[model samples]
Target: MSIETSEPTGDTRSRAAIKNALGEQARALGFQTMRITRPDTIQKAGDRLLTFLADGRHGTMEWMEANADRRRDPRQLWSEARSVVMLAMSYAPETDPMEALARPLEGIVSAYAKRADYHDVMKVKLKQLATDLERETGDPVKVFVDTAPLMEKPLAQAAGIGWQGKHTNLVSRDDGSWLFLGAILTATELDPDPPERDHCGRCSRCLDACPTKAFPAPYQLDARRCIAYLTIEHKGHIAEEFRAPIGNRIFGCDDCLAVCPWNKFARSAHETRLHVRAELDNPPLADLLPLDDSAFRARFRGTPVKRTGRDRFVRNCLIAAGNSADRALLPFVAPLLSDPSALVRAMAVWAFRRLADPDAIGTARAEHYGCEQDEAVKKEWDAGTTT
Candidate 1:
C-alpha cells in the first residue's frame, strides 16, 4: 500500500521552514492543531472497515460500503497524494452539554450541531491552507472535510492529532473529544508527525453510558441502535425498542462523548463560528413540533440540524415528546397524526398514545384508524390500542 516518493530537490532548510510556517498558518486559520502523515499510514484501516460493514455496523449508510477502498487508503482516492496534512478544530462546549438531558420537555442536539455546520466552516479553512501549501511546494493539492470518503480519525491519529478513543472518535489530550477533523492531501513529500498512542485503559464509561447500548465492544459502534443515527440518519419509523432509550435527543446523541474523563483538560472552543447558539441550546419540543417545512428551514437555516429536513427532524421531536410525558404537547402532536409523511404520522401516533389516557387513545383511534392509509401508521394505532 506504500507509494515510493523521491526526495524533494530543494534546500532542506527551506522545506523545514515551509512546514513550520504551514503549522503557524493553520493555527492562524483557527485550527487548534495541525500535523502531517504519509498516505500509506492507514493501509490497515481498510480491513477493520470491511469487518464493520460485514457486521452491519454502518446500518443504512450504504455509501460507506460503496466507497470502501477509497476510504481505507488515501492513495486510491488521489494517485499523486504522497502526504496528508491533518487538522483538528476544537468545538468543545462552554457549559455541561449533558444538562439538557434533565429537561425532558426540551430537545437535545449534539454539541457539534449547536452552531453553524462544521463541514462548511472546516472546508473554507482547509482550502485556504491547501492554496498556501500548493503555492509554496508548487504541487497539486486536494482538501477534504467530513464530506469526503476518507478515514479522518485514522489519518488524524497517524498525524499525531489524537488517538481514536473507545467510542471510535478522535480524542485529543489537548482538544478532548470535541475535535472536527479535516485533511489536505498533496503530491509533495513532507515529513510525517509521530502518531498518538491510546490513553484509554480499563475505563468503559463511554460504553456504559450509552442509552441504547450501541457499542458491542470497545472501539466499535452499531449505528442501528445509536440514538444519533436513529434521529439523524435513520429515515423511517424508529424501532419501538429504541424509542424510550432515545430520550429527548431530537437531532443527535452526545452521552458517550460528554462523559469522557479527558475533557477535564479541554477548554471551550475559541472559534466564533463554533460557538453555541442560544436558541438551539435546549429547544423546547413544543416549539419544534409545530414547525412546517419552511419554518424548520428558517429556524435552523445555517446549522447542521437543517440537513435532517422537517419530516425526519419532527419525527425525532415526536419521539422526545412521547418520552416527555408532557400532556401540553398533545395538541402539537395531534395534528401531525395526518402528516403527509408516513414517518411523521407513525411517530405522532406513538406520541399521542403516550401523552393521552387509555380512554383518550381509544377515542382518537376510533376517529382516525379508518382514515389512515399507511399500514405502518395503522399498525401504530393497533399497538397503541392493545397496550
Candidate 2:
C-alpha cells in the first residue's frame, strides 16, 4: 500500500503545525499527559484480550466477545482513523484508597466512583480534544472514553500513557493507578511515540492484595470472581464463597489498585470536584440499606453508583449487612423481605437469617417466606436455615 506524501504546497507545513498545536492544546486542557500512537502498537494488547475473551474469562460481559474484530484493530472501528491520541487524567486522592477496608464494617466505594462518574468528567475532555483536532485537520474525528467498543487499555499502553500492570489496568510510573483514560481517533496521521515497556516484574502486591483472587494469572482477570464485577456488573445472587471476601465493598472494589507500591509516587488530585463526599466516603451499610428506588436514583445522580440501580445496589448492601454481624441492622433488613424486586427480597431474607434470631428465622420462614417465589431466593433461604 502506497502512502500519501506532502502536497508540495503548504499542506505538509499545515500537518506539522496541527500536530504541534494538538500537543499544546492537550496540555492546556488539563490532561496530565497525551501521546499519539501508530495503529499496530496495540496489536499485542488485542491478542491478549482476544485470548482472554476466547477463554470465557469475561463472564457475562458479552460485548467483549461481540466486537472481536473492532476491538482488535482500530481501523475496523473507523476506516478513516489514521492515529489514536490517548490521554490521561489524574484522580489520585489525598487519603489512602485502601483505608476503607480496615473498617470492614463500612461500605467502600471505588476511588473512580467516589466522586462524579468519570464518564461524565472524561467525556467532556474527550469531546474538546476531538473538536480541536477536527478544526485543525479539517477532517472527521471521533472520541471515546469507556463508552466505545475500542480497547482503551491497549491503546493507552501503545500511546506511551502507561504499561498494563499485573492487575491488567493501565498504570503510570508517575500516577500509579489513579488515572482515568480517554482517547480521540482522528483521520490525520500524526507522529507516534514509543510504547512503554512492562515494569511489573516480580511484583505481586496487586495479586496478593485481592480479596477474591480474581487474577488467574499475570495480566489476566476473571470477572466472575472480581468484587467490582460482582457488585456492579453481575446482577442477582452473588456466589456464596465471595460474600465474605467482599466485606463492605458495596459498589466496585479497588484492593489490587490500592495496594501497588507505585502509589507512593502518585500525587493527590488537584480537582476538588473529584474529592470524596463526606456522606459516601466509608458510609455505614445501614445508611444505604433502606434507600427506595427513587431515593437511590436521587442520591446517586451524577455518580457511577447510579448504574447498579436501587434493587441491585441494595442487594449488595444486604450482603454486607448480613456479614456485618452488627445485629442492629436486622430491623432494617426485615422489611425488605417483601421488597418488590425478588433479588432484593432474596438478599433481605439472607440478611435476616444472618442477623435475626434462630427463632426469628423460623418465624420468618413460616410467615413471610412464601412471598419469595424465585428459585435463587428459596435456595438461599433453605441454605441459611440449614446452616
Candidate 3:
C-alpha cells in the first residue's frame, strides 16, 4: 500500500515550497483558488453518496449508481494517487439571476449555462496546472472537471476551498456559490490542508427558494424534483405538477444559488470565456420557441444547453410560453403544434390551451388531433379538450 513520496517525508521546507508553488501556478493558469488534500479525505462523501443512491434521489442519472465504488474512494479509481489538488474558478454573474424570473416573456437560463461550457474552459486550465505539477515534482497526475466520477466538492471542502452549504452546493465566503470545481490527482504524497468547517448556520434561503422543492432537507437534494434535472437531464415529459412552478425557466433553475446570502460577496467573472453571452442572458420566449434543430445547434453550439437537444429544449420553451401569459408568443407556439418531436407537440397542445380561448382550443383540437399518432400528445389533446 506504500506510495512514493515526491518530497522527502520529513522535509517541511520542501512541502511548503511545493504547496506555495502550486498555488502560484494554479492562479497563473486562471484558477481563483487551489488547495491540497489526500486521496482518502472523503469517507463521509462515499457514505452520503451510497445513501443518496439507495433513496433513488439521483433520478435517471444511473451513472452515479454505476460508479459508486470509484466515486466513494478516489484510491479505488486510481490506487496510485497519493494527493489530490482541488481548484475553483468563479463564474459569478454580473447581475442577479433572479431578476430574469420576473420577465415572463423571457426564458431564464441558469447562470452557469449562459456562458461557454465550464467543462471545456476548466479542463484546459486544469490540464495545464496538472502538467506543470507533474513536471516539477516528477509525479504522475490525472485531471478532471465535472465529467469524472471523482467527488470534487467533498474533496474541495477537505482542501479548505469551501464547505457544503445547506443546498448541498459548495459555498465560499470569497466567491459565494458561483464556483466551478476541478481536480488534479497526483501520486505525490503531499501534506493535506485543513478541512473547511460548515458556515451555513440557521440559513434556509436556498431550501425555501427551490421552485420544485428539490431540497428534501438541509444538505440533501432530491434530483427528482429539481428544475435543473427536469429541464436538462430528464428526457421524458415533465410531470403535470411541476410545469406551472417552473415559470419562465427553460434551461435550468438558479433560485437556490441566487438567494444565498453569501452571494453579496461574489464578484463578476474576469475570464472572457466565462462571461455570459449577450444573446443568452434572459432571452425572449418568442426568440427561443421558433428554433428548429439546425437553428438550435447554431444558437447554442458551445454551451451546455445544446447538449439538452432540440426536442427537450423546445419542449421547455413551450412551458415558458404557456406560463408567460404574454399571448404574443402564440404565433411561436402554433408552428410547434406539428413539430416532429412528440415531446414538443404534446407541450405545444398544453401551451396552446393555456394561451388560447376555449373556442380556439376546440378548433385547434379538431384540426390537429386526428393526425396525431403519439399517445402522449393525444393525451395532451384529450386533457386540454376535457378541461
Model-by-model lDDT, in order? 0.89, 0.82, 0.89
Q: Between candidates 2 and 3, name the one with more favorable TM-score.
A: 3
The C-alpha TM-scores of every prediction are 0.96, 0.93, 0.96
Task: Please write out the lDDT profile of model 2 over residues 340-371, one tens digit for every residue.
Answer: 88899888887788788889898888887577
Candidate 2: residue 112 Cα off by (Å) = 0.3
Candidate 3, 1-387: lDDT as tens digits: 112236653477677777777788777777889999998889999999999999999999989999999999999988999999999999998888999888999899999999999999999888887887787677799988988789989999999999999999999998999999999999987788999999999989999999889988999999999999999999999987899999999999889999999988888888889988977888888888989999999999999899999999999999988888777989999899999999999999989989998888888889999999999999998884422
Once model 3 is optimally superposed onto the true structure by TM-score, how far is the C-alpha of residue 208 displaced, in angstroms? 0.8
**Where in model 2 is the C-alpha error above 4 Å?**
1-17, 385-387
Cα-based lDDT at residue 84, candidate 2: 89
lDDT of 2: 0.82
- lDDT by residue (tens digit), candidate 1, 1-387: 111124453867666677888888889888999999999998777789999999988999999999998898898899999999999999998877789888999999999999989999999989988987887788999999988799999999999999998999888998889999999999988878999999999989999999999999999999999999999988888999999998899989889999999988788888888889987887988899999999999999999999899999999999999999889999999999888899999999999999999898888888889888999999999884422
- True lDDT of residue 169, candidate 2: 88
What would the C-alpha RMSD of candidate 3 be, to one decimal place?
3.2
Model 3: residues with Cα > 4 Å off, grouped in runs: 1-10, 385-387
Q: Worst 10-residue stretch by lDDT in candidate 1?
A: 1-10
- Candidate order by TM-score, highest to lowest? 1, 3, 2
In angstroms, the error of model 1 at 343 is 0.4
